[model samples]
Target: MDRGAWLFWVLIASLCGASAFFAAGAEGQRRDVRAASVTLESGAVVSLAEVVDGDTLLVATEAGEKVPVRLLGVKAFDTKLEKDVTKTYGQAAVDKLRVELEGKPIRVLLHSTPKDKHGRTIATLFVEEHDVGLDLVKSGLALVYTVYPFPTMQIYLTAQELARADRRGLWSNPAAVLRADALSAEWRRQAP
Candidate 1:
């Protein structure tokens, strides 16, 4: 072959190689996106972006969306509440949730009416096979939020009663001295 023809063929080979390289890179990106979120039979498994509080989480989806999810049957003391005792319990609840969920992938089962008035997704979160909301209730860090009924409402209520009986968490220290009924009413009044 002539020198010019050989040079032309070399240029053609380089262009083909570059095209293949670019295509492979694109496919790798697609695979990464898919790996970010996985769909389970009952729900979607997502990465925890932030634990907003005890009952709410910010989760990342496959499309790189950060969605706020409120646990369907759980309510924790508002961390923003003015009362110091309530705020202490709220902070404890947040700390507990962070320990359980931060830097972990969790399963999210969204409710039928997924969005709340604040546009947050209402979901039941799971770490492996354990229900995160129910666990909180059992530990006395949260109450069974019954405003909107859910399938596990009864279980959550039972857990709350047991926690109260066992004098765990808020049910024990701050709440024991601070009048549980009065604090509960105050928390409910200030709930967002």
Candidate 2:
């Protein structure tokens, strides 16, 4: 179950048959917990373990909990697919991300809409303020995900352009194998 759903049920169970005054107190506790989370997120450093893809990772927080954080601003190729080319690029992306992110101390910056539908945090990861998503786009390992708004959209878009111009990583594939025009059209379709 998602954390929110679990928490909701927990609150309901606690508040059941309680007085209105007790319910108000429970509400205050929830707010206090939220405030604590904000404080924890601002400067919390996490130890990385697994790189799920170019744009997601599994991190071990100080509380000994594993959190799946989806890196904001970029979407990477999925290695799980059957296509050879997609798997090739996906593996490269995962390898690069694992090398750079795994076993490292990194900070997570939660964006305005922090969590996705599945409860994974939507956050920007930093290694000394350098965004991991931007780095991947710069290396052509990921594409800018503009299906929604993000603070660093332009920065990611510029990196993708530079990578394309230099024919780096994913852009290194021949036009016969990877069609730029088709990709561009597809990306446009994803834009809001």
Candidate 3:
């Protein structure tokens, strides 16, 4: 091929490469923007729409959508238990969380893998910079769930130990504790 023909082909290749590079960058920017809008980053204030259970809540997004958020690193007793003792403990935990969340905007810290298999956002919530999950564990309203890894796992476990020792909330009754522990084990077995 002649020098002019070779030079023309090289120019065309260079333009195509530049176009692909810019296109990729633009796509990356768009993803970043979309993530910023949907993801509840640290310190992102969210209104509590409903407390579904002790460990789950519905939060209202800026787009007027209600999203279910499951508290990361903690598990509360199942509120649907047939046993009166277990049911009472579950209801107490729900009431505690509900009182805490009612009429307040809390800050959400989302995990990298934010959504669970159930499509609930796995997050840690804070109110006035206090870790809500840790508080719940400390109060014995919830147990430390170690099935899924989280940064504050050790702290939550320690808090759970203290709550159990102190006989606080659900830990106060041996029957309730036994039922809750059995339920927790069943949940772990079912975890994917």
Candidate 3 colliding pairs? none
lDDT of 1 by residue, 21-92 (tens): 999999966754553343322378877878888788777875667777788888788789776676777788
Worst 10 residues of 3 by lDDT: 31-40
**Candidate closer to the true structure by lDDT (higher is better), 2 or 3:** 3
Stronger candidate by TM-score (1 vs 3): 3
What TM-score do all the candidates reach, one by one? 0.69, 0.72, 0.72
Question: lDDT per residue, candidate 3, 1-192, as tens digits?
Answer: 999999999999999999999999999677544533455555678888888898988777666556678899888878896857767766887888888877787889987778777667899998778888898899888888877767888888888889999999889999878976886787678656
**Candidate 1 vs 2: which has more TM-score:** 2
**lDDT for every model?**
0.77, 0.76, 0.81
* lDDT of the structure predicted as candidate 1: 0.77
Model 1 misplacement above 4 A: 1-42, 174-192
Report backbone clashes per prediction: 0, 0, 0
Task: State the lDDT of candidate 2 residue by residue for 12-33, as single tens digits.
Answer: 9778847677889999677534
Prediction RMSDs, each to the true structure: 12.2, 11.1, 13.9
Rank the candidate models, highest lDDT first: 3, 1, 2
